[model samples]
Target: MNDMLQVARREIKTGFRNPWAYSFLILFCVFSLCLLVINSQSIVQGYSGVTGSMLSLILYLLPLMTLFLGSFSLTAEKEEGSWQLLSTYPIGSLSFIVGKYIGLSIVLLTIVAFGYGLMGVISGLVGMSFDSTTYVLFIAFSCGLVLLFLTLALLIGSLSKNRWQALTVSVSIWFFAVIGWQTILISVLNFLPYTWIKPTLVALTFINPAELVRLFVVIKLGGGSILGPEYYQWVDWIQRSSGSWLFIAVCMLWISFSIMVVYWLWERGRSHG
Candidate 1:
């Protein structure tokens, strides 16, 4: 436990010192403030077009930012031989990875919070009305994006042999997960039987954290109807009293499963070579 905390503290220090961290920080802050432009439009109740667009904007940016930041940090350790040095210590792989996760989560979440906070403050100064509930939910959505996607980033980092490899895989994943998921899902589902589509879609939704979190947040915002009529039944079930809890359960499962895989892979690499 002490070793894990030490690793965590070390990650925190290095994460902030990394220049890529600050570059992402600046980009997110600039993009976040652009929400004011969308706010200029009239607000409709319940996940207004304005808010929905904002959600999409955030979905596009945060996951990639997280993937790059997390992946590069891991890959750099390997490339610089720091990971080899760390392995020489008494600490285990689980402790090191979990510690990195803990520290990176803090660093990324802080950037997320600061970006939104700056946006809120600027909007206030400009006399724009951003709803408190909506503000809170969007922040939650962004934080969820950061936390969930960071796991994926760590996994990519673990798999990559170098920063270049990590960067390539990260972009590929961000493209497929965030940008191309819907089209690919539709095309692939067509090959399945009619009876299989619904369940398959549900299963696939859980496979990608980006889709899962976005869908849950949309439902929580009472905008599930915008997902189109095909999702009506599933969305209805999720809107039930315990639906959010169910979503939370899936998220917990995803984190556990992914972390286990990452740790398993890392420990395997350590053993093999």
Candidate 2:
């Protein structure tokens, strides 16, 4: 546990030292702020009332940044031969992975929280109101999504041999996860026979976490009064739909399988050598 904490601290310190990470965070925050300003008018018109939309935006989009950071995490160390040094230490792989995850999540969460504040400013400008409970739920949802994305990114990082390969895989995964499903859904609708459309959509969406998050959020925002009795429904929907438990279950399955695959590949590479 102590070792993991130390490793996590090292990862966090290294991340802070990296110029690209800081630059990316700044740029993302700036762009999100711009979007909030533009949407402020919509809020006044009652079209943009989701209290957590800004934070949610940051949570969804931060996957790209998280991917880049995480993919580079181990691959860069490996390329520099630093991973060899760590391996020689009294460090466990699980400690290394979990530590890096914690450290990086802290950094990402800070950036998203800042975005949430920027969002609150937009809400105020638009004259929309949200009580304390809604604010908590929004933050909780954002945290869960951020962890889910970063975990996948870390797994990709562990698998790649070099920074470039890691980056390619991470970005490709992000592209497919974020946009590929939508494209597939559209194609299924337009090209497939009518009978197959709904089934295709259901299968694609049911398995796709991104779509689930969006679906859950849209329904929550549109289906209730922000400050009224129906607020519990929105809260309940978010809690269930945040998919934290499901995501953790999926990640555990993914990691267990991934570790087996990586070990097999490692053994094969050694045998070949």
Candidate 3:
């Protein structure tokens, strides 16, 4: 536990020391604040609902932030030959993996928290205080989405041989997870001759972080009535039963799969070398 924490601390320090890392944070903050301000203005003008509109802004930004920050974590280390340095320590491979995740998760969470805080302040100024329950739900589920993205990127980084490939693959996966699923769903329902596309789509929802986050957000914030009735109905059902459970289940699957893939790749690299 102590060693893992040390590793996490070192990772955090390295992030701070890197110029690109600091730049990402600054850019994210500026973009997020601008988005909140723009959307809140539209909401006040009776153009959109606070919850749905704010959530839409977050949905757009979160995936981009996740992809950029996480895609290079392991890949950069591998490129610089620093990844092997950790192996000299007594930490188990699993501990090293977990430590890396912990460090990245903290950084991502800080970004999310900052964005949420900025949004919340603006919403409050517009006389829109978040319901305690709904706020908690939104944060929890969104964090779950972040965890899913982080794990997937880590796996991609471990698998790819270089930073460029890792970045390309990671961004591609992020695109699919964030928006490609929605495009594909629309096309599938339109092109395919399936009467039960809803059920199939619901199944696909488990793998779609953007959809899951949006569902929880819409249900809590009251959909801008932006979603079709079908999506709203599904969100209502998930809300009634427990979206948190589903979020946890999906996140666990992503984390476990990532761990397995990273471990396998690490072994393969060692053996081939």
Candidate 4:
């Protein structure tokens, strides 16, 4: 436990120093302000066009920022021989990795909070009409993305031999996860039997953390009908109070499953090394 905390503490310091982390911080703050300017003319209430637009813009920025920031942090441990130094100690791989996850989560969430908090304050001062519920939802959506995708980052960093490889794969994943989500799903699901498509789509949605969280937020914001007939039941259930807790449980399962896989992989590599 102490070792995990130590690693977490170290990670918090390193994450703040990472140039890539700062680069994203600057970009997010600027983008949030840009969002503020672009939607200034409209009332950004609930899940209106303005708030939807804001959500879309944030979706693009946050995931990639997290992936890069997190993957780089893990890879740095390898490149700098920090892992080698740690091997001399009795620390378990799980402790070290979980520590990194905890630490980096703080750093990334801090960035999210600051970006949105600044935007909220500025919006209020300027008399923008966005409500507080929208901010709460946005913050929840952003935090979920961070916690879930950081698991992928740990996996990517563990798989990668160096930073360049990590960078390449991370961007590729970001593109697929965020940009190409619908196209790829539609293309692949097209080949399946008509009856299979819905089930497959549902399964695939759960498989992708970005899509999962995005869908949850969309449904919460009263956009579930737009998801088409396939998700009618699922969306309806999720909109209910009990369904909200179920969604949270699924996210917990996602993180737990990913972390288990990461630990197994780390243990395998350690044994071989």
Which ranges in model 3 have alpha carbons more than 4 Å from their true place?
39-51, 118-142, 190-196, 224-233
Q: Model 1 over residues 17-109: C-alpha lDDT tens digits?
A: 989889999998989878767785654245767778888999999999999999998999999999999888899999988899999999999
**Residue 151 in candidate 4 has what lDDT?**
96
Clashes of each: 0, 0, 0, 0
Considering TM-score, which of the candidate structures 2 and 3 is the better prediction for this target?
3
Residue-level lDDT for 80 in candidate 4: 93
* Superior by TM-score: candidate 1 or candidate 4: 4
Q: After superposition, how far is residue 126 of candidate 4 from its true place, in Å?
A: 1.6
lDDT of model 1 at position 146? 85
Q: How displaced is residue 38 in candidate 1, in Å?
A: 1.5
User: lDDT value for candidate 2?
Assistant: 0.64
Per-candidate Cα lDDT values, in order, are 0.88, 0.64, 0.69, 0.88
Summarize candidate 2's per-residue lDDT along 1-273 as a digit string, tens digits.
998899889988998888867787787678656655655454322215444455445544666777888778867876898767877788766676667778888877877687678767777776755454445555555655666667666667666888889888977877777757667666667987867765666566545555545445444444334433423543454557554466457545644554454445434533453
Could you estimate the TM-score for every candidate? 0.95, 0.70, 0.80, 0.97
Ranking by TM-score: 4, 1, 3, 2
Runs of candidate 1 exceeding 4 Å displacement: 42-45
